[model samples]
Target: LMEEGYFEPNNESGRNRDVYQFLDGVAAHSKHMQQEGEARRLLRNLIFIFEENDLSQLRNRISELILYFKSQYPGKKDLPYIQQLKGMLREWESDLKWGHLGFNAFHVHHLRLGFYKGEIFTETPRMDRDVAPLLALMQQVKPTIVTVALDPEGSGPDTHYKVLQTVSQALRIYQEEEKPNKLEVWGYRNVWYRFHPSEVTTLIPVSLNSMAVMEAAFETCFGSQREASFPSYELDGPFSRLSRKILVEQYQDIKCCLGREFFNESKHLRLRASHGMVYLKKMTPDEFFQTSRELKKSTENIE
Candidate 1:
């Protein structure tokens, strides 16, 4: 659940906030949490952020950002941006609900390649090298539920599809070796893309309060996105705003079909929007692997 670039700083609403600014905000929030006497807990979930390369010439800019953070935080002046970012992530992880359950974790992969909008497959070696360790990690965790972005070809950036392929391949390898077990691969989409109502199998309604919390987390943890570099002109506000609209729309659609009385009588329905987070059809591990392989082969043919 991590990306190489911190945020799309070019977004108009983001105001050109860079990675350094984002990490600063995250560090500040971590300090605030510490002062509040919050307990520190381990996180089980893994988050990988590839840092060696990025689009828009971000590698050099990230180097500059590291120096900026080093200068800003006297105590951490000697450390690099990646280290500082890791520390901040650890702190944020501590504040997550998963942290309370001692199941939060993250990693910054030092992969050799950077992410170009449509060149993920062209850099096959990097992708395959990255996937080997991931396969091993998956074997260790043996998770039953693996969630991934449901991005289609030519939608958003190509990185999303590459990630989906990598995870799917890893799962395929792991399943071949281990005992047969039930596995569910959940496909999700966010602001960059969306799942059609007909394509969705799950809808987790979110409350206004929960939305606020999510926004706060974004504000605190994603300083870089505060002033985005590549702001979307099509949208009026941040991605969160888009998310709210989508969730509300989904909730309304459901209510309309089920009748307003159904929502009025349910306590949870009263607080939640008309629609919630939408997921695409769930796929079994074998199904996902086959789909990913087919997509990979198609890409190869085109290349």
Candidate 2:
């Protein structure tokens, strides 16, 4: 995906003819067709709808987005994205129920913010729509721990990095205005990035039982990502498999250091030790800011 040098210009006329036919009765037959297949079809043929030139139209509630699609396409059973979204919803709802959200509230807010619509999280004359939700969340939740991903290779330069920047601004504002209590940031990385031995503050052992549980949960939910259209690193398989591979690789690295004899001798702990470990870097609010600063180059006029 990151090829340098000039590439041949795309011929508009040579565009695939199927694009036209696919989108022809999309509004009508989308209900009759498979949700997953229809979602992929929409993505292939009409992704440009999301890239509307108008910035205002680009920003919307997920509800509004769904409504817009429903209005645009009549007689739709549901978009494939809808089915996957439902799966995610079911997972979260089930988790909330299992965890017992008695006194604590579990709120999931969608900012729907992006740089593609020319949105900037950096200092400007006015506040960015993206950072506002995060700022509000801080005031509303008064969370003891705020979690953010450290990975930086998402859509581009990691949509996550951009998200982190905005979050930094939000935390900055929250600190200045609210004078919040002691807060910690739990920084995480998927397969894209990881904490080095020197940086890790904690380690969670990944056991075979835990791996089975994770695999079950992942398979039951996350259908959209399990079968992503534009896959990660051109991988045809699910990211879960790649993640497991990485975990095992890390375990091997650890096994080399500690000596295979140490693990081979441990009767009860051997299985889990062979599986691998999860590294965690817990940071304070100040350390959180410093980490993001180190992650990015150039200065922002946030002050």
Candidate 3:
């Protein structure tokens, strides 16, 4: 599409030229494919093309294609292309399945966390209602390690900060009753914000192959967020790409500060151009709870 002049970089203004050209190209392609009786081929080509891009872009393109196909030939499932497309869509949906709580059930099952049914906080913020269930869940799990985003006010979204506070509150309640064997809290941030070198206590190295796998998982698992309404203004690509860039930059910083031998000597660390590092900050349960409480109070004072 770029070579054919169907798409170009928006040098004039900060707009998504890719998205506009993509939708146009798909519409034209669908029409041509239908006339040529190559709808199945078109579907195959779409799947192949999107695999090269990020999850959000792929999701958006797929959604547009699906709508185009349905409108072009409604109630015609008996057709070969239509049947194949429907089957493909069914498989895709199944693979990217999510629970009512907006979490991948497959991930939860793999982690062996028990599921609890509850209403998702969409419109109104229900602190007590949300915290109560999480507290109960924490007591049941008795997890030694708890990880939450270190998102502050005015971060990517209010939901991230809210979730952190809720988890912290639940942990505080759980600790009051019983202490886990080795309780630890890990604060992590991605895309919107990242921890400075001074703030990071842990630097975990990731292999190039693992990074590729992570991108694939994001594309396949987060089906709903494929077409984000509020994408990052600074980053033109998907969230996964932003995360990758951050990790790589961190690794580069470490190599510049510490000699290459540091990574070479470490048995667990592997160095490569494609390899990346994730930074994390460690905190005590009480410290996390206190931070959460302070955040809550600060927000309240502002209101």
Using TM-score as the measure, name the better of candidate 1 and candidate 3.
1
User: Once superposed on the true structure, which residue ranges of model 1 sit more than 4 Å away at CA?
Assistant: 1-103, 106-122, 125-128, 267-277, 290-303
Candidate 1 is scored at a TM of: 0.60
Model 3 per-residue lDDT tens digits across residues 31-124: 4532232332233335444543344775788787668666763333344434444444433333333321233322332211112112132223
Where in model 3 is the C-alpha error above 4 Å?
1-127, 264-274, 293-303
RMSD of each: 11.5, 14.9, 15.2
Pairs that collide in candidate 3 are: 56-226
77-147 per-residue lDDT for model 1 (tens digits): 23333554544444443334233233323322223223322232434424447677777677767788888
- Write the residue-wise lDDT of candidate 2 on 191-215 in tens digits: 6666676787866668777667666
lDDT of candidate model 3 versus the reference: 0.59
TM-score for all models, in order of appearance: 0.60, 0.59, 0.58
**To one decimal, what is the Cα RMSD in angstroms of model 3 from the true structure?**
15.2
Better by TM-score, candidate 3 or 2: 2
Instruction: Tell me the lDDT of candidate 1.
Output: 0.54
Model 3 Cα shift for residue 196 (angstroms): 0.8
TM-score of 3: 0.58
Two-way TM-score contest, 1 vs 2, winner: 1
